[model samples]
Target: MSLAARAVLVHRTTEYEELLARHGTHGQAAFFLAARGRSVEEVRERHERTSRALAEVTAAVPLKWRRAQVERADLDRFLFGPEDVVVVVGQDGLVANAAKYLTGQPVVGFDVDPGRNTGVLVRHRPADAHRLLPSVTGVRTAVDDLTMAEAVTDDGQRLLALNEVYVGAPGHQTARYTLQAPSGPAERQASSGVLVGTGTGATGWLRSLWHHHSSPLPLPAPTTPHLAWSVREAWPSPDSGTGHVAGLLAADETLRLVVESDRLVAFGDGMESDALELTWGQSVRVGVAEGALRLVG
Candidate 1:
């Protein structure tokens, strides 16, 4: 940390103004990190607008735009200097990936969807980020609850999502896949597709299905524990058909379900995976990530 460095504000177009007004002050030099994916002109215009707005408040306050072509090292050099506090206001994906790379620093993410911002925020370290997430920033809405936003991946590595990760053919037709689990075995399902939901994913498509486990049951206190024994156990149905596990289904990284025999393919967070493939006799591991991203609620 350096005396020259103060707080950094990372935001999309909708959030640029208020964030500046909140953090930019007399002594603090506000550093701005721009979002990626927009055209160069658009980015420049936004940067100019943000800079101008900050100037109106205090001309001496240095509000500088991190150049659009800036790389990860550039983020390191410019954003996280001593005494610098980083404020992220856009997508979390970019934020998480960037947070994963950052060094010692204090960071506060302002927006709700940090996942989509990975294109810009992937340069920081995840452990360094803390959520100062707000429900409303001057009428710009943000999801304050973790459930409204996508689930955080275990190890804070990725987003938890199952409904959007279906496997099947293209066109107006629906895709299908076979479902299997270690304890439950296999079952052939027919519909738009099959979904594998984590506790975070329970509210969406998985909520509509009958067989999926919604969430882990809360345990009773140690002193209140009753003598419980199972006389007979009933389990879900078994099947021989094929289907795809929806939500963040990374092939090699998440799980590797057998798809070689059924022409199965995996899609993750609604995008096709080049890393994962279906194979025979391969046990597919799917569940919640190693941890959860806590919501303010």
Candidate 2:
């Protein structure tokens, strides 16, 4: 909590902003939404609320502290100092989006429109910033170090995600690969993809996958130092088997995969644009990341 520490405010472009960008004008954007039976006024109100919330949070920062702003798209290019305190101003997914690019820096999440986004990560409001900022800087508040997932390839490419990491084909074509569980025999499988998720992700895409597939493994809690993995739609054929479909990976263990298809992809937290590509015979290892998200309320 040094006085020289910087505060990095993180945010994402809103729907209204996207509409304006796409339509080229407010009137056109309104007309576009009107055609879809959606009201532009509502979108504008939410955008204004987000703007006010961001302004309030910015004002709440200590006057002496150095501050900077970064959009979600620029996070990969933004440099975060060791003593930086990250302030995420958006939905829970935005927190995940920022977490991958961060190290051990503490994060404060603020929800702009709570009614529309009842997220688990964004648990605070702009009004709480004044009181919370001091606690975060002083290290006097409770912080939850949430576990995260990692995917590393043999060629030195690595990716991290706050929720989960998906490894599969680039398109709808079946992903052909050999999956080796942490403590069992490897199995050649053909299916949609493979998903490795953390406890924070268990409530998201992982949950949906778990519901469809029954397994003896229990889902990890938010702070658990473990990961859950599952293969989507494993097709059992003469060359491929579905013996290893789901399992749990300990913090020290890893699930390995070897590509048998022409090309495969690995992405985290649903950001497919920023992903890792693998060629035939490439290998990847999925496990719990060494760094965890330090979230402060």
Candidate 3:
């Protein structure tokens, strides 16, 4: 018999909240959306759905366990404990955002609205939490150890990516860097950017890049131990030789990049809000992260 655990509900800001923030008032936001055939009431209903889903998950938790709620914006500052079991009541992107920050705690992805949400990470509904809690709390349970990517700068700064890592100049401009992989000659290259993608992210930006060419590379599973790297729009010039533009990275392998530009940025999972700045002569090592996201199905 196992004891109870802390259940942290992870949620994102509502559309209405965002609209109000952008338009400066709910009335103004409603008028803006009304012009596009949307009503403020519709946004309010979606917000209520998320709130109701949170309540449902809360009720599912056993009384002996500790319960808390957290917004996605506050996730970076939140301290997660070893025994914590996270229940995310939002879309898959919320889960992706949280994955980069988690140590190894099991995350229960419960979709707030199944009809409208294509939540690949949120496999279960809020009502399913009643039966799923045991899987996280019980001794014998199935947990998917989802692989994650990491970027380590030469200066010792590190960033984790749940989906893919974009290393390039700000504003998606041209990037100049040296590409180095295991058992290969270092090549200088000029390109828009380099994207390091995991199996889970293959269906996202990587998929588009994969289709950019006639020959498509095989994508790995979400829990696969490997990753893929692709350089977007590699330009060959006298100063830049492009040989190693795309390749697969083994579980133990890493892709090392030496920045040649005046400034470079590394961000993960399509979130421009979080990133690392790389300067001239600096290098960053991109590879599999030491930790994984324990996803509860």
Candidate 4:
């Protein structure tokens, strides 16, 4: 017996009409989730428009509407059977936020910005273990419309680190914060915010705020004594070398910063973090998280 193929179609706006037109079939239900908050009337209208276009190809196509923050357990129920595909649609920020709920499944990402036109998808089948996923045809044409790609995870971690989570003191403007890494303790600049980045976020705003170059240039305490004393470069390098500089700060997708006195604010990847407070002389751990996300072309 042949498999009754099931595909989950996810997109943000009406622009994906062309891609949906290509892969969506009659029996498969297209799930529409919007990143932005829209009124019931507006959402219903959008669904109706897409439904009409889908019906032209095949009748009996079910269209469902739900709040964008679809839970992981619910998705497990929705994709109970095998051969089901999950597609996530949004700009880079929205896509990164949605990834948290996806956990360990193959995720197809669709973004509209050409600069953000990238996707991470994973294939886990043993037979096709090493083969690459086929690149989305006409991707350039849809560069402004939709850029679809996939992300894979071996240990069920999201691959895209678009920002850093920061934790800092409350109320006090420009508080001195203690940064605790595995090795030792260091005093970071006196500021309302302090940020840490993943390897991927080295090129973001953290570099600019510190006046450090993106490439492998070693960071020294700036000649200005005030900035140098507060924002010191603990890591030492023999000379400038590509990809050999210390980890970045201020602009990481997964930033965790500690504020002075006793307040902790942690947020990353454009998502909100829980408020935490730690007393003085207390230790806060900081480091990299090891995991792999699947990448789809």
Q: Is candidate 1 or candidate 4 better by TM-score?
A: 4
Candidate 3 off by > 4 Å: 1-4
Candidate 4 lDDT over residue span 179-203, tens digit each:
4332234434454444544332323
- Model 2, 1-297: lDDT tens digits are 355878899999998999999999999999999999999999999999999999999999987779999999998899999989999999999999999998999999999989778668998999999988866867467899999999999999999999999999987469999999987788999999999999999998998889889676799998999999999999999999999888899999999999999999999998888999999999999999999999985
After TM-score superposition, what is the CA distance of residue 291 in candidate 1 from its true location, in Å?
3.0
Instruction: List CA RMSD, all candidates.
Output: 14.2, 1.4, 2.1, 13.9
Ranking by TM-score: 2, 3, 4, 1
Error of 3 at 118 (Å): 3.0
TM-score of each: 0.35, 0.97, 0.93, 0.44
Candidate with top TM-score is 2
The weakest ten consecutive residues by lDDT in model 2 span 132-141
Q: Model 3 over residues 1-297: C-alpha lDDT tens digits?
A: 654589988999998788988999878988999899988998889988888898888899877789888898888788888788988988988899888778888898998889786788888988888888756877677788888999999899999988999999999999999999776899999999999999989888987877774335687788888888888989999988767777778889999999999999999887777889999999998998988888886
lDDT of all the models against the reference? Answer: 0.34, 0.92, 0.87, 0.34
Of 2 and 3, the candidate ahead on TM-score is 2
The worst-scoring run of ten residues by lDDT in candidate 4 lies at 221-230
Per-residue lDDT of candidate 1, residues 99-170 (tens digit): 422343443443333344332222332232322222212134322222111222222323333222343333
Off by over 4 Å in 4: 1-86, 113-162, 170-173, 181-185, 210-259, 273-282
Q: Which lDDT value does model 2 have at 267?
A: 95
